[model samples]
Target: MPPADDIVYLDHLASTPLDRAVLEAMLPWLSATGAGNPHSGHRAGWRAADAVEAARAEVAALVGARPGEVVFTSGATEANNLALLGAVPEGWPVVVSAVEHPSVLEMLPELARRGHRTAVLPVDRDGRVDSADLAARLEAGPAFVSVMAANNEVGTIQPLDELAALCRACGALFHTDAVQALSTLKLDMRGQGIDLLSLSGHKLYGPQGIGALVLRDGLALRPAILGGGQQEGRRAGTLPVALCVGLGAACRLARQRRDGDAARLRLLRERLFGALSARLPGLRRNSPADGLPGCLNVTLPGLDAADLLLDLPDLALSTGSACAGGRGGPSHVLLAMGRTAEEAHGSLRFGLGRGTTEAEIDRAAERVAAAATSS
Candidate 1:
């Protein structure tokens, strides 16, 4: 690994550093928490419950949903499990996009095992699913459709509004994993006809171990955890006051800074690309033109991204999704987008966030270009 001070992080998609404001909001709840177990009947419990509900309202407002619709959970993985496994019926037909995060993709197998029919909606080379295909699939009237607001690996923003409208017309519920899009997109669930939305706080400068599944009013999901009756019996657990406060603060900040931050990130991304392109030959950009401004996925012909990352330890980057960790393999999203196996191996994902600076992008590009070419 390179020297610690020289390291530049380009993997915000995996996780973001906690915002100082968010930490400040959470400090009271974490330390001398006058708020006790939210489930209890005492005054302290009432205080805790109020804080949790306020946080829930903040999250709901961020996504344009009612406060009652948001059910807090451990993280997006659990939120996804609650959406797919908890909402879909035993023998219903479900349509899911091919390039979704593993949280949404992996749930299909369990749905299939439970006798629910599963259909994978394919994407074009740019990793976008045509609305015509979605309309045709909804003609069969599947139980629900799950598409992401933006892909985690390539940052391709899907046509979620059209897909949600199609599902609504067919009387099918629409679920979206908006964890990646929360920081970059203005997600109005009502306007988009989205019935459910999944979120993870760590994706947007909030705390880890906190997420939410937002369901439409009057819609009930089978709870993954069954114990004390909580969340109107839709989900049962004691909510963590500190993490909830952090997530809410982060959501508020995201809502406040989205557009300006996106423009800044886009400019920095272009600079990184330009700098690297000047030095590194045969660089192929896998990210689409309409992709999120913050994420840049590029492929360097003949250079294994894993090997390059190992060689350039000064930069914190990714070969694929962080869920793949250091195991080293082709990205499912890249393969779904029609990249060959070798192309996938050579691809690297660079995620930029609010903390990212022009200086870091320049340094990272210079170092990465030198390292990749030399390797």
Candidate 2:
């Protein structure tokens, strides 16, 4: 029943293929332009710096932030770490969602070691943080609150405006990891009242090894990495001019194609889900109905997700969080949403991207249904 021996990548949630336009934009900075450190004051260095600034502006424009507010980082993980650790005032608590990414979860142990109180707000079955419960937790006083813009595993979009309003009322800083949501969803930093936001280049069809953190004006965050005066001394290092340019070009392209892409992906996603459900009547969709257009998380009764994935090599997918894929653990996102360990283990995430086609989705759906039925 499954297709034979041909690979069709459907794991966009893990990472996306780089756009040709983005690659073309980056080609000039990689070698032809001259190797000059962005921190240096020489002519070539200034040229590189100018390109970095232009990229910064493009990234800022994507999320409605000023260029000065964007701080380059290695990736969204680093950006999240910087935003959380750097922005938290001394003696204040930190509150993060229970379904946060592993980077945020792992940081809690260290924060506890440093004598910072940390609380994890629980989510509903839909994988959304309960605003009322979050408010209750924050009643203790000022604390930095971080909730991701969207759930990576489940693709559930968070109510950022409500969360930001709550943080503002509690006089606390708010941060969002927008890595999974960026370009897929339209965002306005000012309108949402978000103090900090993190984005990764790879998630938006750009190069890896680069990301940006947008900070609210006048918000002073202590520098975690100290050295040369790059990134306005916020994040210290030579800027990756080529990767930055790629990110900028990717952002511009994403903006141009977002509406049409979303519509197309949504149709394909529905078709895929419908096909799978029709074939396996007991199949359950894990992601929320109103979630992001391109992502779908589903579970088939009596099937081991890892085994199913292994059997269907033609259809690339994930058992749960890509970060925790090989570890053989129940998904924390599902557990946070009140699913049992068995249900969590049976779930798989299918993330559609700009390159995904109707034929590919159909083939993938057939493979998934075959796997589920066979198991």
Candidate 3:
């Protein structure tokens, strides 16, 4: 294993370094040759519009959705807000999983203020939602249900198909925040029965500030943002041509390399886990063994995760959700999975990426184990 001073990064869940191919694809759009405005009928504008449409088709292909169904948003947060707020009628009840991102959690207050009922479905010790409980809630008639395809903190893959079926049986719409699952899993929008799906570009080796919401046809909801007519009036703003191009290219690359990437990442993850567990006998893995391919959360009992992170500057990692960074609180996801406050506070998340190598994983495990023991 290499020395800890090498500065290996393993926080891909927080964000990924942009792929070179994606960056090159976006470069023309950022320059004068790119479309100035997609709305214009002029040659430059039409060319830009053509680029945007091409990217849209690429994004749609990755998820098995039509180009028309993909609505560009600022990121997954905006996409989630659009999906959740747009799908329901005024004053209807809503249900979301307990382990959802703060964007979804924060929206509950506004929904309540608007006289809409909200229910948070709980998860088991493994951080998986109870389908029976979800079905029961749906039977009570919520307008829609939101569940993440995979957890960001603990990396538990939800039974999206079963949940979608339950929502369908009750005639409710189903949405998934697939920001963390985009490159890690195979996404089939129609096959999964997902009425709405949110994805972030930065999470999949694309540029930030761009994402998309895939909505089923004829699903009506009010627009969250109102401005110049864009994105077919579902979302209103000037399209981000460069970011869109990057996202589309990243999606295409991911589709091409998904199987090979998953196999390599799984091997790296297991080796890291096995090495760390052997070095530190009391170490516990927070993520499920069968969860997403490249994410792992582990708890080192009696060690403060924040302290461990700060002490190990050579390793870039996270205590839990990067969205909760600077908040100084235990992970809500870990708590939902039955971890004690101390246990939750003792956790760290290691998210592997395309650039991560087996040697890097081994070195990271050794450094992490050393940090845990010293702390």
Candidate 4:
């Protein structure tokens, strides 16, 4: 079914291939003259700085933020740490969803060490955060609540607007790890009551290791990385102009094509699932009907996820977050939803993206089904 055993990338949730348009936009910055240090004061630096600012503007527009509010980072992980540590005072209570990304979930130990009490909001069977439980937690008075806009593995979109309103009523700041929501959802930071947001470029068809933290106006952060006082002294590092350009271009294209792309991806996902489910008996879908259109999580009860990968080498997929790749453990996301270890380990996540094609989907489905039936 696959054309010449070509590798089909179904792991877009982990990372996407860089877009050609983004590459073209970044080429200028890769040139010799375009390689000036953004911190330098000379003409070269000014030109490099201009490119970075233009990129910043584009990323800001993507999330309905002002250019001045965006802070460049190595990636979403750093951005998340900055937002959480900056807004949440030591000894203040903080609440986060149980299925949050490791970037958010891993903060608990450090926060505990700092004397900040942490409470986890549990998710329903559908992987949606419990709004009523959140209300009960707010009674304890939290300094902030960190909930993701969408789950990276299950693609379940959270009721962020409602959550934000609840946080506001409780006089608590709200932060969202929106790395997976970009390009697939309309993000209006202020209108959505999001005090802080984290994003990644690679997840949106841009360069890896480059992301931004969009902060609300008048929000201040203690510098997580101290150096020569760059990025208004909030973060100090020599900015990468080419990567910024790529991220900007990616954001621009994603904003322009989001609606159409979402519709197309949804159709492709259905087609893939339809084809595979018809062939593979006992197939179970983990993602819900209201999940993100770009992602599908499913389990073939008797098939081992590792064995599935071994059987179909041409289709790139994963059991869970690529960040945990090779760790050989059950997905915490699935486990938190009450899946047994067997079911959790049997799951595979299909993350469709902009360049995904019907042909590719058909090939992937056929291969997956054949493997499932034969295995």
What's the ranking of the predictions by lDDT, best on top?
3, 1, 4, 2
- Runs off by more than 4 Å, candidate 1: 2-5
TM-score of each: 0.97, 0.97, 0.97, 0.97
Candidate 4 residue 23 Cα shift, in angstroms, is 0.4
104-187 per-residue lDDT for model 3 (tens digits): 988999888888899999999889999999888876675688999999988899999999988887788899999998796898
lDDT of 1 by residue, 1-375 (tens): 657667898999999989999999999998765559988999999898898889999999999999998999999999988999898866778889999888888888888888888999999888898999989877766567899989888889999888888888878889999999999789999988999999999998999999999989877678889998888998887888899988999999999999998888889888888888888868998888678889999999988888888887778999889976655668888898999999999999999999899899989898888888788
Output the worst ten-in-a-row residue range by lDDT, candidate 3. 1-10
Q: Which candidate is the best by lDDT?
A: 3
**Window of ten residues with lowest summed lDDT in model 1:** 323-332
Question: 1-375 in candidate 2: lDDT tens per residue?
Answer: 345436787889889889999998988887865587777889998888888899999998999899999998999999988987788888789999998988788888888887899999989999998789878988888788899999899899999999999999989899999998886798889888999999999999999888989999999988889998677779887788899889989888888888888888888889889988888889998988789888999987777888888888678798877777767789999988988889988888999999888889888888788777777
Model 4 C-alpha lDDT per residue in residues 1-375, reported as the tens digit of each score: 567448898999999889999998988888886779978999999988998999999999999899999999989999998888766865778899989988889988988888888889888877899778888988878567899998999899999999988888877888999999887888899788889999999988999989999988888788888878998988888999999889999999889988898898899888888987888868999988778888999988967888788988788898899876767888888988888899988999999999899999998888888888787
Residue 274, candidate 4: alpha-carbon lDDT = 90
| Candidates 1 and 2, the one with greater TM-score | 1
Total backbone collisions for each predicted model: 0, 0, 0, 0
